[model samples]
Every structure is written in structure tokens, then in C-alpha cells.
Target: MEPFQWKQAAKGPSLFYLSSWMEGEALTAGFTGRDGGFSKAPWQSLNMGLHVNDDSKTVVRNRIAVTEALGWPFESWTCAEQVHGARVHIVSASERGRGRDVREDAILDADALITNEPGTLLASLYADCVPLYFYDPVHRAVGLAHAGWKGTVAQIARHTVEAMTAQYGSHPSELLAAIGPSIEDCCYEVDGPVISKVEPLLKELREGGASMAPNALIADANGRARINLKEINRQIMIKAGILPTCIELSQMCTGCRTDLFFSHRMEQGKTGRMASWIGMGRGEPFS
Candidate 1:
């Protein structure tokens, strides 16, 4: 069964909830779609990114709409600048809602955001790049990571897990992880540079006795390869000590399903962004 289940509302942001996580206590986690907001062409209707040339006010409205739809307060919306690095910023109550509306106020130069602070919604924008989610029910900590090809090469998955372990005493064995919508290998082809960086990671996984998908990296005759980023991240999580059974991988591909998602590659770089959000709240019901 698909882990991120889409829920359409009559008048709100269309979203895919990480359904299994919703069954837990006061935790809201999911990805937004390209619908039910107020942005114009190129950004279309529901662009959630402020830095992508979308009107900042319109982007804020869309974001506020998502928060309302999730039954989360707009005041709790928080984010990072997402520099595609491995740095994980531990979000505190003081930093709550930092990047909710403006880029300058967001967590700087960090691709991963983790928090044990309830009511702080950690959001990271995405078009095709993978969204990595971490939840440690034992410690009541949650995290969101933006894993572009660069961040993946830097092992952001491992970094987030290690940060949660250090900051919140979270055991990776108790961490439930999820890989959200992104371009799949079917729609994501890469050149020598990307392949060079990814191959060593594959080698490391193989040497570490990890069972990776055989087609995780498929090569072509032109020194190019199709990479399954989600699977690669899944293997990275396993290498970082998260159990395979505890991880949920979304099957939706942004490139393949542009009708339901925004694809920077497919759209030739003129596109909006969706958001991946995760946070725990105080006695809040799952909306």
C-alpha cells in the first residue's frame, strides 16, 4: 500500500498524509500537493516556496492554507533555507516560525531540521528533491530533511539520524523514517559527476552487507546513469541503523506525476515547490 495517502478537501490545500504516523499521538506529518492555493502561472495554484520567484505574500497564504488544513497554527510553521548540505539544525522553541513567511528569517544554510519542541512545524520545500522524515516516538522528536542530489551525496540521512541521537537521545532503532515524493530513477537520469559521487556510496553499502535494490544505479552507454534516490536514501537510513521495516517509502514520482506534483526538471526549471512537514503538537487532534 502507498504510505503517503492523498486527501482532497473541498476548500483547502490538497495533501498526502503520512497516514501511519497520523495514527500516533498529536503528530502531524505529510507532503503538500500542487493544488488549492492562490499563485499564478508557472507557480500555478499552490506554490509553497518563497524564494522561487513566487510572490512572497501568495506563498505565505498558500502555506497558511496548508497549516489550517492540517489543523496546525500558521504561527507554528517553520523552515530552513535548504542549502543542500548535511548540516542538521536543532530547532528550539525560540526558533519556531522563523522562516514561515520570509527567506531571511529561516534557518540558514541547513538542509535538515529536527525538533523535540512540540507545536513547531518543521517544513522544507521541494520540487524533485527527496524529502526525508524522521520520528522518534520514544523521545518525541521529529525531523525533516531536504535531500537533493548534493545533500544525498553528503549523506544527509545519516546526519539527521546522528543529530537526533545526539540532541534528543533518540535511538535509531526507535526512529520511524520516511522517504517522500521525488523524481524516481525512471525520470531522473544523471551524468558522470553525479554517478561518480554516488558509486562509492553504493560500494560502501555493499561492503557493509546492506541489501540494496539491484537497479538502484542503472548505467547507460553515454556515461550516464539513472539513480533511484529514494532507495539510495533508504539504504543510507538502514546504514545509519534505522530498520527497513520501520521506513515508509512513497511511490509517487514528481517527474512522472506532474499533474499531482511540481517537477523542476520536467518543467524545465520554471516551477513552484511543494512542502514536506512534520511536527508534534500538544493534545492536538489529527485533522
Candidate 2:
């Protein structure tokens, strides 16, 4: 399928929008570009990271607009103070609005969140980490995962699938997945240490009609190997039982699309966060 369209939101400064195509229920999933909120430059408008050192008040206001646009209550959204780990929190009705509360221990160090509860928004913050959205139309359940290179090699996407199967009785054949906007291979370069972790999973691509000879490694200008993260994680999902036709990856890269996204690498550790969030609709899809 073609990539989702990006549009400007007239309600604020320069907000952009994203939508997914799993061809089922009224579920919404997308990432916020660096716009439409109350934060200052570098943050620009909608900077959603609570720990990004942006003014807390601005972050709160931006989040409110996000939920409002999704037709969800501002208080019902859920998120984590992600620390680039593989922890996944299974959200429930009892834990509704937990991320919006003042508890310091609100699902500590989690990098992923999944829930079947309609109207509950599950998401994680990122500038370059891949955001993976999961939906089982047959089961009417949805999940979200944050995959950095570390998480991808750890098979977090596979773990998410297994979690859905065990927790919500979701079947792999019935699931639809979308890997949201993040750093693409064009802008993501790595060293031997990182390549060692990704090599096993990348064997498929090495054989898939690329310019390289089989069993040969390709390095960059600086002589460091680069890996295609989207391809690697796609393998993880397929290995975990998702059909090849059920997956989508963003064509846009945050590190490359500087005007539209916040790239932590491009910004040199001083940038705002873009959020990838998913929520079940209010019985029916909303415009």
C-alpha cells in the first residue's frame, strides 16, 4: 500500500497527521510531527516527550490536543517513561489513565504497551526508534511496540505477537501490523557490534536481489556496516507468524525528513519527541 498522507492542521501552528490501513475496526495510529503544540523552537509546536526538558505545561497541552483530535479523553491516554528496554506493559481497564496520573512508578522502564480496551490510547515516545502497531481484526484487539536496534534484535516484535496470542487469544493469521515512521536505513549507520546482533536476521535480505554477493558484508564511507532496520523487523514479525501481506513500513525517515520529524541523531541530543499512538474508536470510526 502507498504511505499515509501528511497534512497540515489549521487549529495550531504547523501540525501534521498520520493514519494506518489494516482494513478493520475504528482504530487510530500515527506519530506527531514537530508541530501544533505550545512548545518553543527545537520543540517547535507539539513536543510530546515528558522528559525532553521541554516545559511540562507545554507537553500537557500538546497531549490534550492529540487525544482530542483522536476523539479520546485527555485523561484516558496511556504512555510510559521509556528507557530503551524490552519491557512491555499489558494495559487493562483497571490501569486506565495510569500514564496520565502522578504516580512515579507508573509502569517503569517499559518500551511497549498493548491493550484491547477501546478508547484507551497506548503509545511510546521516540525520535528514531521504530513504532510497531498491531491489530487482530478477527480478535478485535490491538497492540503497540517500540523497537530500537536493541529491541529488534531482542525480538520484541515477536514477543508482542506472542503476548497478544497468550493474553488476548489473538491469532497470528488474523493480525495486521504497521511499522510507523522512524529512522530508515538511508540515515541509520552502525558499527560491527551493532551489525553482529542484526546479521543473522539480515541473511534474507543479503540474498534478496541486492547488489552484494551472497555472504559478503557491505560497509559505508567510514568503513562501518549499515543495516536496514525495517527489513530486519519485518522478518521478526513474519517469523512470529504474521503474514507477509499484513505488514506496512513507513517510507519517511525522521533523520532524513528533518522538516517533518524530530531526529535525535540529527538534532544531536537536543530535540523534541514524536509520539506513535494507537486507540480503539468510539464504537465506530470518527472523521
Candidate 3:
């Protein structure tokens, strides 16, 4: 079964809820689609990123719409200036709502955001880059990481788990993880330099007892290869101590689903961005 299930409302942001997490936890965790908001052309309809040249006011409005749809306070929306690094920022009450509207207010130079503070919605913008989510029900902590090829090479997934463990005393065994929609191997092809970085990670996984699938890296004659980023991240999580059975991987490919998602690669760099959000709330679940 697909973990991130899409839910459309008559008049709100069309979002995918991490259904399993919402079923029994006071958590709102999921990704947004490219619909039900206010933005023009390239970013048409529901662009959630303020850094994408969309009108700042319009982007803020779309963000507000998402918060309204999720029943989270717009003031609780916190984000970071994703630099594609493995740096994880620990968000607290003071950092809540830092980057809700303006890019300048966003947390700086961090690709992952982790927090045990309830009611703080940690969001990161994405077009093709992977959205990695982590939830530690035991510590009531949540984390969101932006893993593009660069971040993946830096082992952002493992870094996120380690950060959660260090900051919140979260045991990786108790952390539930999810890899969200992104460009898959079918659509993500890379050159020598990128493949070079990924090779060592594959070696590490194999040495760590995690078997690599044949399709993990499909090489062509031109020194280029298609990489399965989600699987790579999954293996990294397992190598970092998360059980394979506890992780959820989304099969939705942004590159192949332009009708429902915004793909920077598919759109030739001209596109909007979707958001991945996960936050623990006070009492009842919003979704």
C-alpha cells in the first residue's frame, strides 16, 4: 500500500497525508501537491516556496492556506534555508514560525530540521529532491530533511537519525521514517562526478550487510547512471539502525507525475515547489 495517501478537499490545499502516522498519533505529516493555492505561471496555483521567484505575498498566502488546511497555526510554520548540506538544526519554541513567509527569516544553512516541540510545523520545499521524514513516537520528536543528490552524498538521512538521537534521546530503533515523492531513477540520470560519490555509499552499504539491488545504480556506456535515491536512503536508514519494516517509502515520482506534482527537472528548471511537513500537535490529530 502507498504510504503517502492523497486527499483532496472541495476548497483547500490538496495534500498527501502520511495515513499510518495520523491513524493513531497526534501528528500531521505529509507532502503537498501542486494545487489549491494562489500563484502565477511557472508557479501556477500552489507553489509553496518563497525562494522560487514567485510573488512573496502569494507564496505566503499559499503557505497560509496549507496551514489552514492542516488546521495548524500559520505562525507555527517553520522552515530552513536548505543548502543541500547535512546540517541539522534543532528547532525549539523560539525558532517556531521563523521562515513561514519570508526567505530571510528562515533557518540558515540547514537541510534538516528536528524538533520535539509540539505545534511547530517543520517544512522544507522540494521539486525533485527527496523529502525525508522521521518520527520518534517515544520521544515525541519529529524531523524533516531535504535530500537532493548533494545531501544524499553527505548522508543526510543518517545525519538526521543521529541528530535526533543526540538532541532528543531518540533511539533509531523507535524512529519511524518515510521517504517522500521525488524524481526516481526512471527520471534521475547523473554523470561521472555524481556517480562517483554514490559508489562509495553503495560499497558502504554492501559492507554493512545491506544488499544492493541491481537497479540501485544502472550505468550506461556514457559514464552516466540512473540512481534510485529512495532506495539508497532506505539502505542508509537501515545501516543507521532503523528497521527496514519500520520505514515507509513513497513510490510517487515527481518527474513522472507532472499533473499532480511540480518537477524541476521535468520542467527544465522552470517550476514551483511542493512542501513536506511533519509536526506533533497537542491533542487530536488534524488529518
Clashes of each: 0, 3, 0
Alpha-carbon deviation at 110 in model 1, angstroms: 0.4
- Candidate 2's residue-wise lDDT over 1-287, tens digit each? 44445655587533333444523447777777886778897787778887877887788788888777666787677887777667777888887776663326356777778888877888678888888888877777888888889998777888889989998899998899988788876788888788877776566544653333332335767758756666677767877788888887677888898788889888888889888877776534524
Q: Relative to the unseen true structure, what is the C-alpha lDDT of residue 182 in candidate 1, on a scale of 0 to 100? A: 98
Q: TM-score of each candidate?
A: 0.98, 0.88, 0.98
Model 3 TM-score, all chains together? 0.98
Model 1, range 1-287, lDDT digits (tens) per residue?
89999998886788999988888479999999999899999998889999999899999999999998888789999999988899999999999999998899998999999999988999999999999999999989999999988999899999999999999999999999999999999999999999999999899988998889977999999999999999999999999999999999999999999999999999999999999999897446554
lDDT, model 3, position 111: 98
lDDT of 2: 0.75
lDDT, candidate 3, 104-157, per-residue tens: 999999999999998899999999999999999998999999999899888999
Kindly give the stretch of ten consecutive residues in candidate 2 with the minimal lDDT sum: 208-217
